[model samples]
Target: MAWSRDEIARRIASDIPDGWTVNIGVGIPTLVPRYIPQGREVVFHSENGILGMVPLREDESPDPEVIDAGKNAVSIRFGGSFFDSSVSFAMIRGGHIDLGIVGALQVSQNGDLSNWSTNERMIGGIGGAADVCSGVKQLWVAMMHTAENGTRKLLTDCTFPLTAVSVVCRVYSDLAVLERDERKWKVVTLSPGTDLLEVRNATGFPIDI
Candidate 1:
């Protein structure tokens, strides 16, 4: 069985440390704020120009004027600070963020990331990905383990354009929790009904489970 979305959220939440500033990229990374524990003093930064943002209400968009990196409408929470894009990049490049959660298209064995684009589909710009990957203390990549056709996304090497090389420290996918060891990716936790060999077979690499 594949890991549920809540399980993936918990795995990402477990890695967050108290009082650390975090920047979450678009997609599944947005879910991290929902599972943060109480009194942890976590400040979430948005490249769309907000810091210390609280999770927006799911029912209604609080402020049509306010939004996140993904351009999703949001509301400002008490104690949240707002800044322009230049200032946001400064914070990212200055190493003020402790951890970043990002979605990826492909990840190599050595932890290279390629989430910026899909060769066949021209979406939008790469945004602040390059800056965040290089500046954050640690990076957590979140995505499904396989493509829609069941092709492996985590591999011995990434074929998509590289976003950052050797920057990913951990991964949270629908199939398992993975960590990078030396030049190899290790399966730290397999999904229910998935054994060690099954993970290795799906990874298409020498994964240490």
Candidate 2:
């Protein structure tokens, strides 16, 4: 079976190196903190100026004020700090973030990111995505392998608006984990019981083993 949203989040969380400062984006990326391997010490940063972010427990009430970039209520871990949006973006642009986990609408074989649009379902702007993609020391993407219409999201070339070019280091999809090696995307891991053919068929672009 394919990895569920939580499973995918867990897989990525377990792989984060200890003591690294990570800036997480919206969507499935928000589900990561709760699943970070216990005992690992990673600082989570949110674009809207919150650091040391923890997902609000279901039992917790919304603070309205303390939230992540997606505007989801989040709890700040002890010693966490808040800054203005400009300062938060400064940290990203200063190349202090070790890794960024972001969602995608499509990813090209060349590792371009397409996350924003001009139409409905859009945020009406790129909203810090460009900074996150361009400024992070390493950028990785989390998304489903296919679009809602069953279209391949791993494409020969992204058809939607691009967020950044050649910025992605890896992609964690529902079906597989892909690592970028120069011009090729290596299938690093597959979901249990999933075959390479299924992944290949699901990808719009050619991938390497």
Candidate 3:
């Protein structure tokens, strides 16, 4: 079976080291915090200005005031702090964040990312993605391997407008986890019941197993 969205998030969370500050992008990335191992410290940063964001409890009511970059209601951890967008952007631009977990529309073989916009809805949507991708020490993408129509999103090059160039260090897709190794895409791990052949077929570029 392919890795479910929650499973992919869990995989990414398990890979994150303790005590690292992370920025979670929209989509599947929002699921990361719920899977973080207990006793581990992962400082989650939201572009809107929250530094200690947590997913709302299952039965817990959302605080209309507390939300994430996606504007979804979330709770805050005890040590969490809130700031204005200016300070938040400063933190992002200053590269204080250790890891940035983002969702992608496409990721090129060279690690180029195109996530903020597409030709269809091109007016606005360029949020802090550009700054986060460019400034973060490491950027990990969590997304589906292909579009709903089965088109590959892991391409030799991105067709959509670029968010930032060559910034994606790793990708956690429904099918597998691929990492940049020696300037080439390498299969780090495959989803349960997912084989190399399936991943190879799903990827748009050559991948080293």
Candidate 4:
């Protein structure tokens, strides 16, 4: 059984503690808030300027002016507060957020991340990853295990420019849920159809699933 993307989001959401302030990054990171049940008392912060964002509207149109750090159109929710980019970033840098969920293109065994840029020269951006990775106590990375060409993103070491060094705590992907153990990655849950050996072959890093 493959790990459905929505199931991955729900699993990540379950890990979020009640009363926590979470910073959801671009990509699948945004799906976390949707899985968080109402009355959970979780406060969401976006890098652009919204703190306390509600779950995305089911049928509402995207707003041109309101956007996230990724510049995706967003809707404002009640109890949501808007601030300047500097102030919002200050909240992340000042360690106000408890948990951060970010999407990654690659992650090293020591928890280094590279999500902003691919091999392509023109579309790279580091943005707020460094700040969030270093500042937050808990960081969760979500992405596919392998590239379309079948190259693994979980590596013994990263080839791309790193966003932050040794900052990730856990990873959720189409394949499994993994955690960094000292200098190696430990697989916690195997995806339905995946076996341990197959995952081991995919990731060059030494892993005990």
Q: CA lDDT of each candidate? A: 0.84, 0.90, 0.92, 0.84
Minimum summed lDDT over a 10-residue window in model 1 is located at 117-126
Candidate 3, which ten residues in sequence have the lowest lDDT sum? Answer: 116-125
Q: What lDDT would candidate 2 get against the real structure?
A: 0.90
Clashes of each: 0, 0, 0, 2
lDDT by residue for model 2 (17-61), tens:
999999998889988898988899999999999889888878889
In model 2, the worst 10-residue window by lDDT is: 116-125
Q: Could you give candidate 4's per-residue lDDT for residues 1-209 as a string of tens digits?
A: 76777888988888788999999988888888889876787888988889887655769887788877777777766788999979988999888899999988889988888887777652447778888888887899988788879988988788887889988999998888888867867888988889988878888688875
Candidate 4 deviant stretches above 4 angstroms: 59-62, 122-124
Which candidate tops lDDT?
3
True-vs-predicted CA distance for residue 100, candidate 1, Å: 0.9
Better of 1 and 2 by TM-score: 2
| Candidate 2 Cα RMSD after full superposition onto the native fold (Å) | 1.5
- What tens-digit string does per-residue lDDT give for candidate 1 at 47-94? 878888777777865686788888777666678898888999889989
- TM-scores for all candidates: the values are 0.92, 0.95, 0.95, 0.90
